[model samples]
Target: MARTPVLAAGGIVLRREAPPRFAIVRLRKRNEWVLPKGKLDDGETPRDAAEREVLEETGHDVEVHEFLGTLVYDSGGRSKVVHYWRMDAGGKPVRALMSDIREVDWLPLDEALDRLSRGYERVFLENVGPIALQAAANAERERRTRLRVAAAERRRAQPAEQEPAAGAPVIAGARAADPAPVRPAVTPEYAAADAGEVAGREHVVEVTAPEAPPSSAREIAPIAAVVQPTPRKNLIERVRDWLRRAA
Candidate 1:
């Protein structure tokens, strides 16, 4: 005789948080903490049964997202097969009224893992835990991306009005039609300094005075350099001229 499989369904109900949390309830028959589940009603689907059982046992509305596959075990000389899913405890919080449950509460993943007595239940958590955490991470990444896009759009929509720093070099912004010229800071010393120009042929302007030519030499030619004329008389001659004038 072929043994018939017992159909049951449940979920790993996840409350969205940093690491996420799971719901655990105590069974009245065994008095052990287990994920909330119940047997399938006649002609009911596994997904429906899982959602229905989760709500009925935990008294919280749940949204079933992904089917987490099934686990088969031996119970009372028959195969008790249960289908599980990854469900979200979505939206705002509400008061959870217990139905067909004893002492139900939310627990951290590690605590929930320790509370589950069955190896199959632990296996389900190990599989679904990473999935739930990864989902939360993806949601956060999408949210940040949306914020960045919004910021960029806002920048594009607003007009640019940034003032240049004080005493900084600025290019003229007005067009040829406007003709508004901004004056630059031009110090006197900077304008007169060497001008950085190349020299013309045959002549150079000397920056300093040169020695006077000897008194014996007369009628000199134009030199290669243009120089300031030195005082023709000696200091002793100038002193004697002043003395004679005083007398």
Candidate 2:
């Protein structure tokens, strides 16, 4: 007949630091340094037990996150199964450490693994440590993203300050300021339409007509030179001229 497995739970508690750290505890009885975990109380769920044990051992109230994994091994003659979750510890400790825990040490993953008294626990940590660290990093990135979004929202909510009008009055002794050129806000769609209209439209130019000459100046005709004609002699004048010539 197979025996029932002894159930336990804990956390890979992460502390916010320069490079981040994990929490481990020293047992009071055996002086064995191990991950913060304990056997589950009756009627308690694994999740709740994990959070409770981590708080008691590490003395920092942690926000429980995703389930990391479970470690199954032999403890004394019975099978032991320990469940773990990713937990984030912030600020200072809210409560004192439990009597079962002698002390708590926050360390980097490699150092924490080396400090553990049990080989199985070390192997478990080696696998899950990266998972916990990644969760912490993701949480931090989310927090920063939220802060940026909040800042952007605030900026959008505030009223924009009015700019001074172009060609503002100059001071008595100050140099006259040049007016800034006003550019129309043209969207790409509008710009394309404007370009098409300009290209299709015909160019119109205006020309001034020359004035006609006055009537008085045009009425006068050109004058020609006059000549007198010699008169023809009558019969009496011809006879007189003949008698005179004969005399």
**Which one is best on TM-score?**
2
**lDDT of candidate 1 at residue 112, scale 0 to 100:** 90
| Candidate 2 lDDT tens digits, 1-247 | 8889999999999999978998999999999999998889999999999999998999999999999999999988899999999999868999999999999999999899999999999999999999889888998999999999999999999999986589875333333353332232322211222211332222232322225542442222222222223343455666676688879
Measured over all alpha carbons after superposition, the RMSD of each candidate to the real structure, in angstroms, is 16.1, 24.6
Per-residue lDDT over 143-184 for candidate 1, one digit per residue giving the tens place of the 0 to 100 score:
899999999999999988998789965444423354333232
Candidates in order have lDDT scores of 0.71, 0.80
Instruction: Sum up the clashes in candidate 2.
Output: 0
Off by over 4 Å in 2: 163-247
For candidate 1, what is the TM-score?
A: 0.55
Global CA lDDT computed for model 2? 0.80
Record all residue pairs in model 2 with backbone atoms less than 3 Å apart, i.e. clashing: none
